[model samples]
Target: MKIFLATGNKNKIEEIKKIFSMENTEILSIKDGIDIPEVVEDGNTFEENSKKKALEIAKFTNMITIADDSGICVEALNGAPGVYSARYAGEHATDEENNKKLIANLQGIENRKAKFVCVITLAKPTGETYSFTGEVHGEIIDEPRGEYGFGYDPYFYIEEYGQTTAEMKDLKNQISHRARALAELKKNIDEILK
Candidate 1:
């Protein structure tokens, strides 16, 4: 089973591959001659964005496509940076910029609770689509640490692990938000593949 994934994020591609490698499903990126369209994620919800991207790509390639839209939502900030996590600081800001802004926004604030959220959409060429969501509850730290992971991982601390996502590089496969989402995806794929 070779499914087309509508994304250019190498990190996401790698993560998905690692989880689904045993499923015997070849997850091919849109860059692999699929010519998938760049769908604008103007939706207010993660599910909307995910399904939009998946359906957009499926329309072009006429193949099964998977798309994900994820972000970090801060509880103290009223679930802020939720759908706009990618462009939180600015539309053109870098990951470092976004992280810095997030930290600064919480300066002097006691409650630093937050969570990482992911929504994945799977679409068939015939227009059928399904969605799944994953979330990892945690808090935001004042300082960054570790060299692994990207985005706000350095400051997103997991209560169960007692370490930031970046700091828990060795254990990311079992605790990260993406990992949780992938776990769900793998379960569904297993039933389908079998």
Candidate 2:
């Protein structure tokens, strides 16, 4: 069965592909020559955004579609940069820019509690949909500390691993927010594919 991943971000595509790998189940993304207009993410929550993207793409391609909306939510900031994680500094903000803005906003603040949240929505052409959510708790560090991963990975410190998500390398595929969410999806794959 073929599944359309409704996103153009290369990093997200790679991560999802790795976690959702299955025999006879092929995953395709925007990079696979699927031409669809970008979906606006004006939702107040991750689930809403994920469902919106999934439904839109499923309707357009008449295929089973999956979409995810994820972000770093800081407890101190009242979960700010939540839905706007991608464009925290501004629309089209680069990773570095968003990280910088996050650091600045967190300066001198002792409460560094934060969590990475991911919501995945699966949609069928008939508009039937299901959603899954996953989260990894961590603290926000002032200095970025890894050579791999993207987005807020370098700044997210996992106490148990003693390393940021970026430094975890392959281990990230097992424990990251997206990975956990995909794991949930995989558990129900048989029923969803029917």
Candidate 3:
């Protein structure tokens, strides 16, 4: 089965591919001759945005398309930067810049509550769509840790692992938000593709 993921981030694509592990599934991007129109993610929720992207891409490709919208929600901040995770700092902000701003915001605060959330949507050419969500609870650290992973991984402290997501890069295939979402997704792919 050829699955075209609606995303421009190579890191995200690679992570999803690793998590899925489907031999017949081929992940491709919009730049890979898919020519899917850019879907506007104006939704206030991750699931909404994921659906919009998946549906839009599926319409264009006339094939099965999977889209994901994810972000970090800080408990102290009342789940801020949730759906706005990618553009948390501002529109078109780099991962490093966003991570820096996040750490600055938590300066001198004790409650570093945060969690990563990912919502994945699968849309078929026939207009049928299904969604799945996954999350990993953790706290934000004052300083960034490790050099692996991407986005806010360096500052996200996983209580279960006692290390930041970046620090667990080698094991990210088993822990990150995207990985978690894919784990759930894998169970449904067989039915969706059929």
Candidate 4:
């Protein structure tokens, strides 16, 4: 079946495709001649935002749509950028801008504890939907470390691998928040395809 991935980010699309590559599914990006309406992500939680995006796009495309709303929650920041991760620096913040802002806000903070949380929502045209969540706990470093991966990957330190999320592309598909979420989604792919 053709699964429409509701996202404007190429990196997200690429990562998601890699995650589901083994499945017999066609993963299409929203950019593939699908001009879906942009949903206002004013929800207070990741699941809410994910559902909004998926349902809206599914309704428009008449196809099963998947959406993910994810962010890094810093313990010291009181999750200041929880739901506002994509636009943390501003409405149209770039990855670099958001990372810089995060680093600036975290300066001199003793606690560097943080975690990445991801919520995935799968929606059919009939309004049927399913939700799943995945999280990866780690700490944030004061400076960037890797060149790959987007958003806060550069500073997201994973103790197990002794590398940032960006530095472990090969391993990320097995342990990152997005990867875990997609893995859970894969477990229920039969229901979604139905």
Best by TM-score: 2
Model 2 lDDT per residue over 1-194, tens place: 89999998999999899889899989998788889888999999999999999999999999999999999999999998999999999998999999999999999999999999999999999999999999999999988899889999999999999999989989999999999999999899789878
Question: What are the per-residue Cα lDDT tens digits for candidate 4 across 7-82?
Answer: 9888999888888775467888865877878889999999999999999999998888999999999999998789
RMSD of every candidate to native, in Å, equals 1.7, 0.7, 1.3, 1.1
lDDT for each residue of candidate 1 in 1-194, tens digit (9 for 90 to 100) = 77887888877787766655764567898456656556899999998999999998888887788889999999889999999998999988889999999999998889999999998888887787887788999999988878888889899888787888988765886766767776787779655434
Question: What TM-score, to 2 decimals, does candidate 1 have?
Answer: 0.92
What are the per-residue Cα lDDT tens digits for candidate 3 across 86-193? 888899999988888888877787898898999999999889999998899999987888887899998999888989999986687788777888878888888877
Ranking by lDDT: 2, 4, 3, 1
Give the best candidate by lDDT. Answer: 2
lDDT of 1: 0.83
Q: What is the lDDT of residue 107 in candidate 3?
A: 77
The lowest-lDDT stretch of 10 consecutive residues in candidate 2 is 29-38
Candidate 2: clashing pairs of residues: none
lDDT of every model, 2 decimals: 0.83, 0.94, 0.86, 0.90
The clash count of every prediction, one per candidate, is 0, 0, 0, 0
TM-score of each: 0.92, 0.98, 0.94, 0.96
List candidate 2 segments past 4 Å from native: none
